[model samples]
Target chain A: MSLAKRIIPCLDVNAGRVVKGINFLGLKDAGDPVEIAKRYDEQGADEVTFLDITASSEDRGLILPIIEQVSSQVFIPLTVGGGVRQVEDIRTLLNVGADKVSINTAAILNPQLIFEASQKFGSQCIVVAIDAKRAATPSGYGVFTHGGRKETGLDAVEWALSCYQLGAGELLITSMDRDGTKSGFDLELTKKISESVGIPIIASGGVGSLQDLVDGIKLGGADAVLAASIFHYGEYTVREAKTYLRDHGVEVRL
Target chain B: MSEIVIVDYGMGNLRSVEKALQQVAPLQSIKVTSDPQLIRTADRVVFPGQGAMPDCMRELKQLGLTEVLLEVANNKPFLGICLGLQMLFEHSEEGNTHALGVFKGDVVRFNEAQLFDECGSRLKIPHMGWNQVEQSMEHPLWKSISNQSRFYFVHSYYVREKEAIASGISRYPESFTCAVARDNIFAVQFHPEKSAASGLTLLENFVQWKP
Candidate 1:
């Protein structure tokens, strides 16, 4: 039996609504997070990630209701990230039916939070997201926080190793350099981190085509591939991506 | 319609399981609870959990569910998922935790040395993501789900059955028991709620299954 790779469709939500391309051609409501998540589920997405990009504290509570609504209807794993600063945030998300919580800045600020959160909630639910950019550091990729606007000066590979050691169940590695470029995932960055750690790695950032998803697993050595624009703007269905990956000899859950 | 009570010892997310059940058995009442009395009164018991085995055992004890779960598993139609499956065995390699010993097996962690496929590529631990399960025995829960259907799995340790109770097996570079069944008990190493259609089919079968 083969372990099929996963395809996750990420939804950048703001104020409890899906952001990043609010003007999709066919969606009844582009901003409805639940509708978008349900659509992804219907498309056979392995998992759906909701990145809360809300800027204000009052808007932060918006994601909870959205997650609760989605989890009730969509029968799949939902991972919520963005603005997860403490253990309470993780708890709040999990309680509302989020299967996993991704911690980025808070994890860098207090690596112990990873340890504590993992110890308390089990590492399976704690995902550490690393935004890496091409740099002149020893590992050649430096970790960036605050939505890739702030550089932590931490070597991406070294930091990945430490995070695994600190009890992160999985790592979501995103390359800031190729994030919006749509060229493809930074194969070098994903390969280095995947080879260094024993946990599963989710390759994110740049995904312009179906071939990029294949490369994320085959060449980049990622266990899962996350894409937004590729599936967001009605460019490609999640099924099409999986079908391409399967034809290209990559195991997917289609 | 019978009520299905999901044991919640504060382990992992149960809403997904509860919601999935609601989808399949809309008429049946499904409850996510830690109350021993509520669990004992249910027609079917769902033991769902995640995290470290030691911590799970501690929480089960703290909630005084060790005896309650054992009693229900022996007497009623019980469904276990993930850690719920692992906790049925006699012992687990994780933190050297002792399980409920409902079945004759040992929960062992996957050996790092043997985690390589035919291509000689090393496999990651936790065995995260979707994997195909080869049916090993006949069971009602396998209804409508084709043999060797893919299911979502995310765990480091697996069951090494000392008896012939393994109902399904999956290979993570090496073959391991991913499902077990005996009498009224059905347990799986993967999450049916997160495994898409085939997984939902399994849960649907469980809802209508007599055993």
Candidate 2:
């Protein structure tokens, strides 16, 4: 079992441009999605994800041209999310070369969409992106929907298990509480979900440094670690993060 | 320029495979098509697939491509990727579907009941990432690449064969066939296009291979 842990750099795109923000709040332009993704591919990133931060709020499909550009330039797998509502939407994205389509709010509204999409495509291509935050209630963490604004009063870990059972091949658990904070991944949040699900878990949100990446895998048991602000802001290169993780005994593609 | 048609049965992501081929052999004529004659007569055929076995078989049958693909696989220089490798078997537990049966094998799901060793390192299903691939036997595709070179893989099911057709083996939770080779046909359970430079070299070798 030599499956090396993955290091993915996420690009938060809005209106066709990559943007950055703290904790998913104030948004600012980062760079072009294609250029950043291409750089990461050269840097030996395992995969790249693009989240359309405003597509659902604006009620439109994300920038297909941008996805086209990124997919054409980047050889690695590309997963695109945000505003992906239906099976048709997933087909459209896959047609345009997006390797996988992620669903957040829509999956919450219609849990069957995950099964349908996974059935239509393969489970390997279906990724259920869970935006979760610490809840004040007994469940401890709540699943957030519609770009982290609306909260579904469901236990985050339970939702993850159900999503996997419904054929979601992987789970991208984003800690809304730690998103953009650079405090590192919400290890506790990541650990809880990773322990609950059998599918691969991509620990997302609150990644500030390379150590945070290693911690996501070692401490939280994540199969992959995703970051936006740290990689987007040029605080660290994908190469540097991969090197650090490799040096720390984490198997990463150099 | 050699004619290389990457069979497109509407099953998996074909672009990365298409692009990787273009990058390694820019002068070759590569087309992603379901056209029978094009695939049957191409100098090289890349049967790349992802998704469910039933869906792939269904699309192949629906598109009237099963025979054409079989003809190409047996006669031409062929490379199958992931589900492409599985579909060559007799059956797959996924969707409980019959396959092309080009190879005498069956596909089974990962044994998750006891997914861990005594050391307590649990193996995840879908086996998603770069894992070391040990060369099982010498082949032209292993040229210029080391024996234990890692390739990217994303699969829940794997191929099990009785014969020594496996040219490369990888241990996910156990030793499973990662690659297979026979005269004129080669199949792999990993995505060579996504396996970085080493993968590129394999594709290049395939392009230049005579056998």
Candidate 3:
């Protein structure tokens, strides 16, 4: 039987605090990651994702102490990303109770990293993250690396398939055009990758309401959904999001 | 003094349950424990849940609390919330996972056709909201709780009425069972703690409830 889709609350950490923005602009202090993660955990989130946006650019390790502290306090599965560029980085995060590690800029710069990490740690432990914006040309979406500022010539959908081929178990696709807009998810982008790949797809960016989450799963074919603004601002709790998905016929753990 | 012991399986929301219970019965003693012996001796036992049913079941079996829990359910006060409640069923459609079999039938997904109306309008999944609970019985556990009082719910799969041991129904798109009871065993589809004051009252009643 198919399991219910998961509603994940994303925490974009900068200097140990959670933050959110639109198209990665206009950043605001959300809260402490530990406190926010605990709140989501209590509200019945299937999983929690922490993206260290600043750590990636600085070429430093993730805030392992924060991850350890949060993991120790929270019981559900945790996925960490941002600045996770090396196999050793994956090892450290996993050792500290992170269930999975997501890679974006590193994967683009070195495609073999995905395969190598997956081979050493199993595909389930590795997640290939892709950030995209609507392409200027008619070919396809433009793949964005380095926190959605640098544009890669590669097509978004094609890159996702390549990651899967290289043994990546999951794909977390965020639409730069839709990030933090709360308008809704990039359904076209989500559906394209979901339909093209066998691995689970986590649709991120632009979730404004409960309907947006349901649409991401039903219309976009996403296996899970990730959002920041709606949840961070208390528009709806994670439990409410899951209940909405269930009533709409998505298989999720309550 | 009333003492409630929350079983620690390392898979669900243990702290929230403890905090909610404390608020409900301020004078009541509450302890979170993984030791099988402590659970066996506690006056009351609560099973809180999250994550996969199979993993929870496995953890319970590993800790050897499975038998102790079953014994307690047969003769003592027991409460299960959310996934904790679902685990009391015979099975769940998730991953072919088997439950404690305390209640009959398997927890399955809601009918997709009924999710939406003929016009293609559908209710969301996970059923996350503050919805009203329609009590099936005047069970003491719901003392001070009224018909219109809303409780918090966050579940994708629910127990159908036919297979339910005792049922309290709620409506999202349509009515479905949100709470279940069998002798000393009680389960709630919604989280009373997260439901604010109303939830705290329910937890208080559970604490004060004497078999």
The lDDT leader among the candidates is 1
Model 2 residue B18 CA deviation in Å: 1.9
Deviation of model 1 at A139, angstroms: 0.8
lDDT of 3 by residue, A1-254 (tens): 12346788888877665666312212243366677777788777767899887654543444677787776566555789988778888888876667678998889999999998876665655888999889973437879976578888888988988998997878999999898688999999998887777667889988889999999988998878998878776677788888888898766655
Higher-ranked by DockQ: 1 or 3: 1
Interface RMSD of 2: 1.7
iRMSD, per candidate, in listed order? 1.2, 1.7, 10.1
In model 2, the number of clashes is: 2
Per-residue lDDT of model 2, residues B104-203, tens digit only: 9899999987676434656677788888999998999999999788888999899998677999999876899989999998999998887877888899
**Which residue segments of model 3 deviate by more than 4 Å?**
A1-12, A18-130, A135-139, A142-145, A150-173, A180-254, B22-28, B93-98, B110-133, B143-156, B161-164, B171-174, B191-201
lDDT measured at residue A218 in model 3 versus the true structure, 0 to 100? 86
lDDT score of residue B39 within candidate 1: 94
Q: Tell me how large the interface RMSD of candidate 1 is.
A: 1.2
lDDT at A173, model 3: 91
Docking class of 2: medium
Model 1, B1-211: lDDT tens per residue? 6898999988877888998899889999999899999998999988989888998999999999999998998888899999999999999999998999999879988888777777666799888888999999988899888998889899999999899899999988878899999988999999998887888899888888786
